[model samples]
Target chain A: MQTLEMGVAEITMRLISVIETDEIFQNVMVRGEVSNFKFSGPHAYFSLKEGEYLLNCVMFNATYRHPSGIKDGTVVKASGAIKVYPKRGTYQLYTESILEGKDYGELYKRFEELKIKLKSEGIFDKPKKEIPRFPKKIAVVSSKTSAAFHDVVKTIKKRYPLAGILLFHTSVQGKEASKEIVNALDAADRSSADVILLVRGGGSIEDLWNFNEEIVVKKVYAMKTPVITGVGHEVDTTLVDYVADRRSPTPTGAAEYATPDLIELKRNIDISFSRITNEMDQKIDESFDLVERSKKRLDFLSPKRQISIEKERTNESFSKMIKIVVEMIKEKRSSLLRNFEAISHSKIVRTTELVPERLDSKMEMMKRTVSNDISKKYLSLEKMEMSLNVHDPLEPVRRGYAMVFKDERLVKSVHELKKSDEIKLKLSDGKILSEVVEIEENGK
Target chain B: MENKKVEEMCFEESYNELEETLNAMEKTDVTLEESIKLFKRGVELYKRCKFLIDSASLSVKEVLENLEKEMEIGEDDMGR
Candidate 1:
């Protein structure tokens, strides 16, 4: 209390200065499991928790080695000060030494954490999706510092150049690395990559746990992109493998999925080009065949056929017209003939009446003249009569000249004879019994 | 387009081309002409495959340019 009383401000300042200048700390390298870790602005706080015991730790923004990852549950050698937090009033370490550890306790604790978490989500039990046979784009998720990235890049470039590639730089192992991988996968999923390849070169199981994280595994499972895991060597199996669409032994193998062989692609293209062109050519040929077939069915160019068809039609029409005209002419001729018959009948009647009048007048004149002559020739009449005498119409008949009558008409000639005939004949002046049976061939 | 046989082509290029050709040929909708093209391309691919076989059969010494480079191969690759 007396020391505090003397020059209070200067003494307090000296004490604070001494406290600030003092290097009262111990640096240590511990081998134990990391536990109860926390991170606040510019500082990392964690406890190296061994079985039933704890060692406080701190890693600052600077002097914190292991350029990649550091978190709870990581076994590490840390160098720091065992100091009291003035604000919170707790004993803690301000760490400066930091290195990766290889203790069994640390490794097992992390392994158990990951396994239980992944098992709960069924990531380790789920069936993996199949990788695309032909990928248009490939996304690689791995640490840029790793040789695995180089192997993958080299193999992919050799195999397939046309296929696009997207690299996702990430922490390959250690605590919080799983989250980084998840973030990378999410980014890859957001991109238009055709396939996602989560790969790394061979390493210890602890070194490969980034892929085994439940977060990483869940991301792999949920990714719309097809993911192929190439974690560690052929013997290494991570939770990522169980949930990945496919698994490859190394980063080079992952590239096999990313891109096909350029030689193979060229040959395939050549073959496809040939096949497509051949099919086109065949189609053209088939169409030509069809066209030819149709043309054959229609024989539309024979002139002889046309001529014969025309001839038959013309003949039929000609016959019908001729028949019609002939019928018309017959009707006209009949009408004209009927008129001619009427006129001729009238003319004949008139001629017959005129002829009788003329004959009667001549006969009257002759009668008058003959009466006068008779008076004068009364005495001569006896002489005349005597001279004209004894003329008998039967004289010829009596002299045996035959006379014949047909239907009460005189027949001078016998030329109109047929097989069936009837004739009446008178011979001599007196009627004698005509019983003569002599038959003669007569000529008139 | 030149008549360089697949056997003479770079193994990567020939194999890739062959893969594409096979993919196109496998489609049922492809026409007869397409099929014929595929067959011809397949011939090119077959030649390339033959080349690969020949290459693989060669001894490591025959494959490598220098004797010293042989030592660079991984220890696990001895049998291979």
Candidate 2:
């Protein structure tokens, strides 16, 4: 009431503002082909085009991702807001859902209607629980007579030869195709397959209708192990492609992507071997050079052979020097003994001569003092000896101080020596040979 | 002026970031120092790319086992 006084223009402006910014749209579906898609971590930005009309959309990362991300040519049945961009004066969609292919909304609605109906009847929800990822046993849900089966089998063999492929033969096209395909899908689901492939090669739009059937789609959608749809050529579209967890361009493509290629593995191993070898070559070369360099630094000049030679030379010279020194020491020892003996004998002789000389000097001094008494005594004895010389011939022998003997006779002086007899003479220097023929005796 | 290629191995973002950096520097009007810095970044990417290529190899094997109870594979020995 207080603001009643305000102008109608201001009130109208307020109403416009409320209409522009405050209104929120509820769950409503829009269908279009995607363009200019941009993904930002947790968000996505894109636009959908329908002839002359274009709508901008934003998908938060969570809803945009469903088994896979959104891409161009994806026909989506999105449910979100028609919000205005104040800056661009345009309206844009804040998305909450996603569906695939053209006429996706209607198809999805039908799909969901049938899905709910079948699930309630336990036809779609209670088919089979699980398929194996690494399948030792596998059952296929395609026409046994179809090339699609052959292609799939061949591809599986090429990719993984050990896997077994069992056929759950079914019609792929025609009026009865949908029922048979659904039955086959159910059977394949119930078989030993770890993963089931609802595969059909590219065909006419009408030819692929079996996959588009709501029954087959439901069966595929509710699979436990994981259902892959390889239903057509690159351009072929089918309901199975949307409902299945994965879709490939062709049956072979599905098989190709389904498992890893052993060929690729072999190529990888070869390349890795080459890479490792190249690296090892480089490193090993470097290491070899390093070892050689270290060895050079340690004992560059003196090799083992040279060192051994030097050691041998030193040992030989040492032995030779020892031998020479030993001989010289023996000679010196003998010479020392001889010099010692000569010195001792000379000392003894000198001591004996010194004593005799001392005694002789004392005796000469005594004789000088008693010389007159000794002369008087010698004169008296000589007079008596001359008187007695006539009395005894022995006196003559005493005077001459000689005794002679010839044969058996004794002569005094030279008379007794006058005989021809063999005589032996002895001298201090040497003995001389002598023969005597006559002898004379001076005393006779 | 500087030649270096940047690449990312972990994620698309890493590669996208490298592409963005390259695009920015290749805009013809950058300073010499800025170009050099970008070149250094390119060198880093080059090293990482080479390291990955030289060190990583493709997977060699894939094994799949079927889970359905009805089918039996007695003769196909899979332990190998």
Candidate 3:
């Protein structure tokens, strides 16, 4: 062995150069259980151990978030370049990416443990709040640039634009996602929204693990407004889903559950409008019927109707009298004819021996007497018909004469009228009301 | 609820009032004048609801923008 004086910095620098030149240590993949995991600013420092063998790991860059399952004692496969640190004369693996082991047993175990613990605490058994049937505002907790957020917004706009949307933007996955989600949920709960929707697109279990975090689940449970969770695909269920008031398989479903359909609401409004019009029309018809009934009752008590009835009675009596007079005149004419025929026949038989000239003279005298009696009977019938015409009740009215009435009673004489008394005169066409200022008796 | 005008009322408020108006109109004892008044109110509510649904547009406001700014400031302080 050649003994040479070498500075510590120089030796470390040489070792670093040799390792960098080696292809075996570059881009190597290592598998072990993770331990002593911690974060410093944007960097992560941890150790990967396999029994007594340990490898120091350092992951730089603030944007890269470690897998949620790569916690203390978690089995993982990390890919990185092995580097030697000159300051401490130590070596570490600068990890570029990390993935959960094939079994994924640790994440599942933690999920199950939290599920069982929450179930025992009755957090899952709490009564869910009822969602508003017609919400005025809806708060969405989602990533601003995510497909899930766009899907939720589109569905809500299509279904119901009446509700205003308040977006609480947050990351859906990675190490800082749980904290951001908690903050978003807190903001949504304090908002004036009627309901909140927490949504994300489809992904693997590790990609959706933030929703399964205890902090996010607790924040969902503590919300005053009703919460609807749609974190992954149809088959995916997170711990937050159990604590949410409603669970939808996808973001679109969550938006639909939060809003009322515009078309359906319009249909209901139309139905109500028709009902109102129909009811009003029916009420108007009922009022018209009532008015018609009242008018009929009023017509029955009118004075014109009573006058018409009296006129009908008068006309009936006149017709009966005329029929009796005609029958009497016919019977008298028939009796006279029979009497003349009997007298002529007796005279003819008794004068059979007498001369023909004497018989002719007697027949002439007898015919003259019978004709005189028949003429007399016709004159009397004419007089009777004239008297009947004079007795007609409406005859005077038709001839421009009026019957006066006072206090709804007929005034036959001047004694029934008084000065300053109102009187009604019924004419052929109408009636005239008059005030009597003076009454004069004819040749009193 | 009655104090708010139909034009100023939200969709939920107007919708609920419309339902109540319909129920009141259905009663057998309502007078013609009362029915007419209720009918007028019902029509107003219906028109309001239709207007809300017809001319509506989605308005989305992000609540976390300020929070993101504050978080960025916090990260800068941590770096310092």
Comparing 1 and 3 by TM-score, which wins?
Answer: 1
Give lDDT per model, in order. Answer: 0.68, 0.64, 0.82
User: Could you give candidate 3's per-residue lDDT for residues A138-243 as a string of tens digits?
Assistant: 9999999999999999999998998999999998989999999999999998999999999999876688899988888888999899999988877678999998
lDDT of 1 by residue, A77-183 (tens): 66665665554545566677777766666556776687787778676676666566677788889888889888888888788877778899998877878888889
In candidate 3 the C-alpha lDDT for residue A91 amounts to 93
| Cα deviation of A318, candidate 1, in Å | 4.0
Q: TM-score ranking from best to worst?
A: 1, 3, 2
Per-prediction TM-score: 0.40, 0.32, 0.39
lDDT score of residue A419 within candidate 2: 45
For candidate 2, the lDDT comes to: 0.64
Q: Report the number of the highest-lDDT candidate.
A: 3
lDDT of 2 by residue, A267-321 (tens): 9878987787677656545544443443343232222433465568778888988
Model 2 interface CAPRI class: incorrect
**DockQ for model 1?**
0.01
Worst 10 residues of 2 chain B by lDDT: B58-67
How many residue pairs clash in each candidate at the backbone level? 33, 18, 0
